[model samples]
Target: MFGWLFGRRKQEKFFLEMMKAAAEGEGRRKLFEAASMLGIIIKGAGTDEEKCAQIASGLVNNLLKASGTNINSNEDDQFVAALFSVIACSHFSRILTSQFELSAMLSWVILTAGDIEKIEISNQATEYYIDMTERKAPVLIAAGNSIAKWVNQPTAENFRAVVNVFDHCRSMVGYA
Candidate 1:
C-alpha cells in the first residue's frame, strides 16, 4: 500500500524533470503540459511530505527561470502560485525541513505570501511546524525560528496565531 502511494511520487518527479527540459527548450506547449502534470501531482500525491517538498523545490527553481521570460505575467504567476499553494497546505509540511532547498522554497512561499490567504494556507503551515516540534524539539526549533522570521509581523489575527504557536512550543520543551 505504501509502495503504491510512493509510486505516484516517483512519476511526478519524472514529469517534473520533463517539464524542466521542455521549459528550458522554450517548448511552450510541453511546458504547459508539464505544469499541468505538476499541478495534478500536487493535488493527488501531496499528502506525502517528501514528495511534495521535492515538487516544490523543482517548481520554485524552474518557475523562477521560466518567469524571466515574462515573470510578471499573470498566467505564469498563477501557475507558480497554485503549485506553491498545494505544498503549503498539504499534509507533508514537516517533510519540508528535511531538504534545505525545499525549506528555502517554503520560506519564499511565506515571503511572497503565495496564495496564502486565499486558502489560509500559511496558518496551516505554521501549525504543521508546531506539531512537528511537539514530537522533537531541536529539529523543529530551528525551523520555527526561520519560519517565525517570515511571520514576525503580527496583525491581530497573525499575532494571535503566533502566540498560540509559542505556547505550544513552550509546552513541549523537555517532554519531547
Candidate 2:
C-alpha cells in the first residue's frame, strides 16, 4: 500500500534534525503530528519490519510538510477518536511498533493530561488505550497502580467513567 512512501535510506540523521526542530515551540506539534503520521505510514507496510522501516524513513524525509496537527481545532476531534481505533487495533499497533522510536512518541497519547486530554474524544481514545493496556492483562495487572491511572476520570464528574468500565469488561478475557 505504501510502496512509494520509502525509497531512500537516511533515517537517524533525518529524525535527529526533525527532533531538534520539533523541540521548539511550533515544532513540537510537528513532532506529535509526525508521530501520528508514523502510525499511519507503518500500518500500510504490513508485518514486515523491513518495509515498515522503509516507510518510516520516508516519514523522516516528509516530516517537515505535515500540517493540521491541532487536535483541538474545529473538527479534528473526530480524527483523534479515529486515531484511537487505529492505535487500539492489535494488528496495526503491532505493525506500528516494528518501526522507529514510535512507541516513545505514541506515549504522547498515553501520557496526555489536562489540556490535550480535554479534547472531547467521546472518551473513545482513552477507552481504546484502556483496552490496549488490558490486553497486557496479568502482566499489566501486576503493574497495578500504573494501570489505574488510565481510569483517572472521576467517579462522578466525568460522564463516561461507568460506561468505560463496563465497555472494557465486555471484551476482556481471563484475568485482564
Candidate 3:
C-alpha cells in the first residue's frame, strides 16, 4: 500500500512537471508526454467520474492560464493545440461542455484560433475543433455563440483564426 502511494506521488510529480513544460514552451517531447498522461488518466477513469472531472478541470485551467502568454514559437502553438486536443478527445469532454469554466476556455481557444500566422497552430486548433464537433460535444453551441461575438470584434488580431473557426463551426452546425 505504501508503495502504491509512493508511486502515485511520483506520477503526480511527473504529470505536473510535464504540464508545466507544455505550457511554458519547454519542449515538444514534454508536451506530448504530458498530453499522453492526461489521456491515460482520462481513459482509465472509467466509473470514476470525480477523478475524471478533477483531472479534466485541472488540465483546462492550466491551459487557460498558459494561453495568457504570447505564443513565441510554432512549437508553443503546437503545445497549446496538443493540450487542447487531449482534453477535447477525452471521455469527459461532453460533460466538460456544460461546465462554464471549461466552456469558456474552449471558447477562448476558438477565439484564438484566428492566430493564422502560425499555420500549424491554426491547423491544430481547427483539427481540435473538428474532433470536438465529431464527438458531438455539447460545447459547440456555446462555441458558436462565442464565435459570433468574436466575429463582431473590430480588432484584426487572429483574423484568420476567426475564419478557420467559422469554417469549423459551420461544419458542426448540422451535426452537433
Candidate 4:
C-alpha cells in the first residue's frame, strides 16, 4: 500500500511538500491543499491500514491546529470535514475510530458549524460525525463528556451548540 502510493519519486515529493505545507501553519491555503491531497491518498489507500490511519490522524491534528487558521471559510472547512468523511466511509474508519482523538474532529464540526451559514460544510460534518459515532460510541461519549463543559458555556449562544453536540452523542450512544 505504501509502495504503491509513494512508488514514484514525484509522488513522494508531493507528499513531503504537503506535509511541509501542513506543518508550516502559515495559512489555510496550504493546509487546504494538504487536505486535498489527503483525500486522494486516503481514497486510494490499499492495505496497511495502520499507516494510513496514522497519517490521517497527524494530518487532521495539524490542519485543525494550524497557526493563523481562521476556520471561517465554508469551502476550506468543507474540504477538511470531507476528508473525515472519506476516511469514515473507507476501511480506515476502524483505525480512526479505535485510535484517534475524535473529540478534536467533533470540535471542528461544532466550531465550524457555528462559523458558517452554508449547509454544505454542516452536512459534511454531520456525515463524518455519524460515521465515527456509529463505530465508536464509547469513545464519542467520553470525548463529548470532556468537552461538554467547554461547549456548554452559559455565554456561548445559551449552549445551543453544546446541546446539539450532546444530543448527537447521546443518540448515537443510545442514551437519547
**Which digits, one per residue and each the tens of the lDDT, describe model 1 over residues 67-171?**
342223443343333333333323224322244435434544533545453333344444544566567756445434422332233234433443344334333
Per-candidate TM vs. native? 0.21, 0.22, 0.24, 0.24
Shift of residue 134 alpha carbon in model 4, Å = 1.2
Report the candidate with higher lDDT, 2 versus 4.
4
lDDT string, candidate 4, 127-161, tens digits = 66577668885644544442333222323342343
For residue 49, give model 4's deviation from the true position in Å: 40
RMSD of 3: 16.8
Worst 10 residues of 4 by lDDT: 146-155
| Runs of candidate 3 exceeding 4 Å displacement | 1-67, 73-118, 150-176
Two-way TM-score contest, 2 vs 4, winner: 4
TM-score attained by model 3: 0.24
Let me know the TM-score candidate 4 reaches against the reference structure: 0.24
What is the C-alpha lDDT profile of model 2 across 1-176, one tens digit per residue? Answer: 43367444545567777876555534323322433533534345334343333332233222212322233333333333223322322222243344323432332333232346443453554465567576865423432322122222212222133223322332242221
Ranked by lDDT, top first: 3, 4, 1, 2
Poorest 10 consecutive residues by lDDT, candidate 3:
147-156
The residue pairs found clashing in candidate 3 are 113-161, 114-158, 114-161, 114-162
Clashing pairs in 4: none
At residue 68, candidate 4 shows an lDDT of 25
